[model samples]
Target: MSQPVVVVENLVKVYQKNIRAVDNISFYVYPGEIFGLIGPNGAGKTTTLRIIATVLQPTQGRVLVYGYDVAKDAAKVRRIISYLPEDAGAYKYLTGLEFLELVAKLYTKDPKKIEEFIEIGIKLSGLGDRLNDKVKTYSKGMLRRLLVAKTLMVKPKVAILDEPTSGLDVVNAVHVRESIKRFAKDVGGTVILSSHNMLEVEYLCDRVAIIHKGRILVVGKPRELMERFEASNLEEVFVKLVWGA
Candidate 1:
């Protein structure tokens, strides 16, 4: 097996010196795998993803991306990772194509490379002619597709996505989920995403960690967890572990 692409070691994040948003927890993500962080709201899922993305520092412990410490090698880490936060908004004034172009420029200065990335973005987004339309006119689902395209277009080594399919109709949600899986497999990249959708997580993830109250209750293949708990599905296992139902 390949070495892990991302590693979190005994991570802890505290706010106001009293609220422990993330308790001491740890996990690893490997290349070409979709690892899901499954939890309810206020479960510290967003905080964990933010720390891995280097947007926030851990109060204790450390995160490493491709063996580079997130805190000490943040710039290097940033270059190799892409992050999509929940409720991420696009530039209302920019056309979808233009928005993609702007992101491409930030990662590279070469005109040819930028064009290549734009092309890739267009294919990934599947927005067709809508690429020329202003982002402000796009529906929520369309916007999410565009954002996913932007995140994966550069083919980063790791993609940290928070609720990548949140707030979408069933059709759009399925499209976005498939896109994430396809992109990671095609590029051999690692993906770590947080999702409250149990079925979505079970379908998309190679492995998952069930988190609650800022701590991980279990981590394993979804099928394995179900079998171990003698539950028929992930949702039931989750309820049993987190709520003792």
Candidate 2:
């Protein structure tokens, strides 16, 4: 098998010196895999992703992205990864095109590369002429699609997304989910995302880790987890594990 694209070893995080937001959790994600971190609100999912993205320092253990330690090689990690926070927002005053262009410029100074990335962003967005309109006018779903497009446009080696489909109607949510899966397959890049939606995770993730109360409850292929738990789907498995239903 190929080397893992991401590895988390005994990762931990603490807040206010006493509250442990993440506790000694470990997992590995492979290249081109859509790995899901599924949990309820305040389950430490966001904290884990933040640590891996180099936005937060781990209180213990380590995270390696392609063998570069997140803590010691943050600049290299940041260069290869794109992160989308749970409540990510674009500049309201900037047009969708302008926002994408700005992000592209930050990653590359080559004019050809910038234009190439912008074009990729536009294609991924599927916004057509609306790409010219200011982002403040976009609906919640449209804004999310735009964000997703921008996140993947640069073709980062890894994408860490916290709740990529948080608040959207079914159609938009499905579109965004498909876009994520397609991006991973087409670009051969790894994707790690956290989501509370079990159905979405079941549909999109190649493997999933169930987290609760700052620890990983289980990790496996969704179908394998369901079979092992004698459940019909991920939702049932989640309920059985978390609630003992």
Candidate 3:
């Protein structure tokens, strides 16, 4: 639909030990949709996201963002995309508001736009007066929320997020999830994220690809896959595909 905002075809990645980290997988992400690459740790989900974000080169195949090749037109792809890695850390010494303001300045020279970004970041973060506190004083959940705000506040057309809610408690994860949804719906940004959390995928993604050992076993809406597999939930569908039969 709408010419597919992101496309990955016959993607492959290999390590020095001849490990095929990603093996000829393919998928498409439509504009303004939340798409998820779902799998456990080391399933090559992060590798795939890195390729789309233009951070890692694929050993084989191609990735395109808004018709720009990730390898051939990396600069053009990077112009419209933002990437947030799983282990991203905030500047510990800076106050949360200061960190957000810093990112806003880096992304734009226009003062009005910079102010707009910081405003959006503050609302997305939902940190209130605590944003005045140094990042070093923040809890794990608080820091993660701030990081999420920074990533989406850039207003990138495409956001590549690796484990967006990883390691957060339930309340924090829910907040982060709502922020992601707002980015796609209110900000009109396309999102492609990786996570092992089946419930998160089910609740957050419009469609999903089930990945394991660098391969995609299935791709569809959560409810569609559930009905197709005759399962009660996405996790049950995953278990049937990866372990059953």
Candidate 3 all-Cα RMSD: 1.1
Worst 10 residues of 2 by lDDT: 236-245
Candidate 3 Cα errors over 4 Å, as ranges = none
Tell me the whole-model lDDT of each prediction, alpha carbons only: 0.93, 0.94, 0.93
Residues 1-245, model 2: lDDT tens digits: 78898999999999895999999999999989999999888889999999999999999998999999999999999999999999999999999999999999999999999999999899888888999999999999999999999999999999999999998899889889988988988898899999989999999999999999999999999999999999999999999889951
User: After aligning candidate 1 to the native by TM-score, how far in Å is the CA of 58 from where it should be?
Assistant: 0.6
lDDT (tens digit, per residue) of candidate 1 on 1-245 = 77888999899999995999999999989889999999889999999999999999999998999999989999999999999999799999999999999999999999998998898899889999999999999999999999999999888899889999999999889889888988877888899999989999999999999999999889999999999999999999999998861
Return the lDDT, model 2, position 85: 95
Tens digit of per-residue lDDT, candidate 3, span 1-245: 58899999999999889999999999999999999999877889989998998988989999999999999999999889988899999999999999999999988899999999999999999999999999999999999999999999989999999999999999999999999999999989999998889999999999999998899999999999999999999999999988852
Any runs in candidate 1 off by more than 4 Å, and if so which? Answer: none
Output the better candidate (2/3) by TM-score: 2
* lDDT leaderboard ranking: 2, 3, 1
